[model samples]
Target: MKKIRKKAFEPIDKEEKELMESIERDEWRPVKNIDQEKKKAMAAARNTLRKDKRINLRLTQKDYHQIQIKAIEEGIPYQTLISSIVHKYLNGSLTPRS
Candidate 1:
């Protein structure tokens, strides 16, 4: 005899399965009538400007001044330089020298 059981939460549910089937059948449609060419261009522009998220930063006056000097030398904004350094460090591209 086969065991019949029901778990509180199935790994997958019926609605999810139905949605997957619909997607596989290409029956899914966008809720909004977005223009392909125009929306695609706008999407690309939005992605390029995805740095829209902002955060508060705290720095000592001396460090801030030093960073400003470096930014001036690099011909970029201080905030941009700081963001780049943070990004590199987080991605493991920047390392502390021994």
Candidate 2:
């Protein structure tokens, strides 16, 4: 069998090398200003507050299965159905049909 020769790998060109060096240097810079960091922290805190204010509720297995079946029939997730129900109730648009 004849021996196969491998080609030598070539180094990157000058412009490519300089571009890589610039990227490496810029990577060490601070990602955001102090004011931007503060604003981000405040936004995160507000989100946490909003999430924490929610109440946790429990449902019987039979009720949950019924809701899941209705959600499947409606082509929506059970959580979406719960959210719609809550929204309608809060908005005073939920009414029992005669």
Candidate 3:
């Protein structure tokens, strides 16, 4: 006989509840090539996060102050904010509000 158990916290949504129920029923199985999959995922994560190059940038005083203010509002460093903006623009996800 198998013992049933309840989780400390409830699932937050219908999809989450279904996933939790399936997991509790032992419906999921481990991947066969787990080590290889782990290595590939790690490599992809490293490539995504890599920031190995640097460049000297010039900005007007007003632009610099505005960037700093925006970064502070977003709770990130100004350099990170600039990097994110550039990345989003290159990926075609950033657009002017107007």
Candidate 4:
């Protein structure tokens, strides 16, 4: 015997509604090799996080001190904080102060 499952509620937003409709239409496909796909994804993530290069950056005394203070407050190294700032700015996720 087959059991029928009921949807609890309607999608709340356009993206959610579209996703639900797509699922109903069977537009999504399952990955063929789950293990292989998982390995590839893990490798890609490791490569993304690998920091393989170093460069010299000269900062003024005041600016460097402030960055160190912020890093300490965040409980991360100042270099990591600087790297994060650069990454966020490059990805358009960091906004400039008006």
**Best TM-score among the predictions, by candidate number:** 4
Overall lDDT per candidate, in order of appearance:
0.85, 0.79, 0.96, 0.97
Candidate closer to the true structure by TM-score (higher is better), 1 or 3: 3
Q: Which stretches of candidate 3 lie over 4 Å from their true place?
A: 1-32, 96-98
Q: Could you give candidate 3's per-residue lDDT for residues 28-70 as a string of tens digits?
A: 9999999999999999999989999898999999999999999
lDDT of 1 by residue, 1-98 (tens): 99875544533888987876677689977756567767888989989767877899889999999999999999999989998998899889999898
Candidate 1: residue 23 lDDT (0-100):
72
- How far in Å is the alpha carbon of 8 misplaced in model 1? 62
**Cα-based RMSD of the predictions, in order?**
12.4, 15.2, 4.5, 4.2
Model 3 alpha-carbon miss at residue 53, Å: 1.0
- For residues 76-97, could you state the per-residue lDDT of candidate 4 as single tens digits? 9999999999999999999899
Error of 2 at 17 (Å): 67
Estimate TM-scores for all models: 0.50, 0.42, 0.63, 0.73
lDDT of 3 at 3: 79
* Candidate 3, run of 10 with poorest lDDT: 2-11
**For model 3, which pairs clash?**
none
Tens-digit per-residue lDDT, 23-86, candidate 2: 6578556655889999999999988556334567799999999999999999999887987898
Ranking by TM-score: 4, 3, 1, 2
- The candidate with the higher TM-score, 1 or 2, is 1
